[model samples]
Target: KCAQPRRWKAFDGKITEMDTQNSLRGKELLEIYRSINTRGIPKDERTSVLLTLKWTVKEHECKLTQEIVALIDREIDLMSREVKECNLEGLRKRICTLFLQYIKIPEFNPQVAGLIKVPQDPLKLYKNVYFCHSCEKYLAPTEFPIPANSHTIGRCRSCYQLDNEARQREAYFKYRLILENLRKSEVDYQDDSKIVFLVQLPDMQYLIENIWNCQSALSACSDLYDLVMVRWDKQHEWSPWNTILLTKEEADAHLKLCNLQKTYEAPFIYRIEQKHIRAKNYFAQIPVMSSFLHRSSNQSNAN
Candidate 1:
């Protein structure tokens, strides 16, 4: 009902409200929303210009619906018997021509594509337009905007905003729990001689070596030794990292694998260290002390 600027005047409560708001100003208000009115023009010319504006205000961006136009004509016919049979078919034909003419007017700048296969029942094409579960409307999909995600294909902008808000709330809760637990947990890193070896991981081997080499300086008399192996496979990889060697000192620390794991876990890193290290291609070794025995680089650490 509140269609145009003049119609909105009814809801304004005061005819001079805009003038009143204009009176209050600041340093910036004096610069913006101020304009000169073109008054005292010829009456005929002014009427013609104002009528064009009214038509412009009434026109929807996607053009008027044919059903509304047909309804108007039928109401006219009921009042004046001079109207012949309502030309439904002719009206549809004329509208179809206009629709096709402006088909490319907006230049196909549409964002959302249809979610469902349209014209599911081809015979009902005349009755149903676009299907929107959010607004519960059967109008054109072009009336709504498209979303970036591929999952919910044809949802309107409002529905998309609602879904994103829900995700933000959920993530906030998830991260809060993580932070709460982190604050409660206590860890000990007092033993420097005991190398807490994290095994079966090559990538982390570099970091473990750096932590021992850079992050801390060990006494020359200390063993500088400790190791642990985590058996990770493609089937059990977890996030933060694909595989986690909870106590792996390095990936290629193959010699100390069993001995360090035994010390950390329970069974024995010492008893099995000699047996496994000498086992087959398990012959890779650390270069720190390649003393009495002779072996290739494959038999020892590169550095």
Candidate 2:
């Protein structure tokens, strides 16, 4: 009775590989295997780590039989004593592959259910396919380039690219750079950043092409690399409603700009307001960004 109590206490505490459990499930045994077998570990140190892991499994009560544990122990003991340059990486990986199946089972790990891409009912996958208007056929969801804020799904990515190539072909490389800079700036500001993730590539393209017209609002410069997107009002966090395109020179000047109404003429201010309204309407479709709009509106009301 005293021996059983000591054995249970040994397992109850941190069980090192050298510790022995009465039994172990396949998963626990695999964990023991992973916990040990440290490659590149010094030979003198390796024995201690291996011993701790073996003992840990031996003390735990699980599905593995005593014979299996004895066999594994014998192997480990031989390897430790022989000091042979035997590679165990492949064997360890094989064991991991076999044991991972237990962890991946839905019943065992319900938390991972959402991360599994495969549909529970594979035969019903066809139901998820959408009809692309441009392609004029049903295509899988992967083919579509739907933005997070898009109200309706449209053409697949391939169809959209082909259409752009034939018609309004414009390089979005500069737009991509501007978007990246915007994200970095937001991160530095350390405000809520989820709204940035909500904006997608297609949405950026639309804003550049239609809203800002892909040129400096003041100078109307078209040099892609020279142009940047900046906050309309310097005080506010950048958003679709609160952005303007400017040349690098203009952007620097605008940052130093103290008073918009004083520096810019009424007409200039009005046009900028119009652009803001358009952007506000466009970005409002994104569900997440709408929260920002409401918050901005309340802030404006407070002021």
lDDT of 2 by residue, 61-159 (tens): 445434334544554665666735565555445434433443344443343355566655666577887898876987778889889999988989989
lDDT of 1: 0.34
Cα displacement (angstroms), candidate 1, residue 87, comes to 42
lDDT of each: 0.34, 0.67
Off by over 4 Å in 1: 1-38, 41-128, 143-154, 187-303
Ten residues in a row with the worst lDDT in model 2? 1-10
Question: Mind sharing the TM-score for model 1?
Answer: 0.24
Error of 1 at 221 (Å): 45
Point to the candidate with the largest lDDT: 2
Residues 1-303 of candidate 1: C-alpha lDDT, one tens digit per residue: 011112234564745323222123221122211110233444444334433332322354444434334433443344254333343335334434443332212222111112234444556665546567876766655556755665543766677788899976754453343323222221122222111122223323342232223121112121222232222221221111222222223433432344544434444333233322342122124333242123323334644
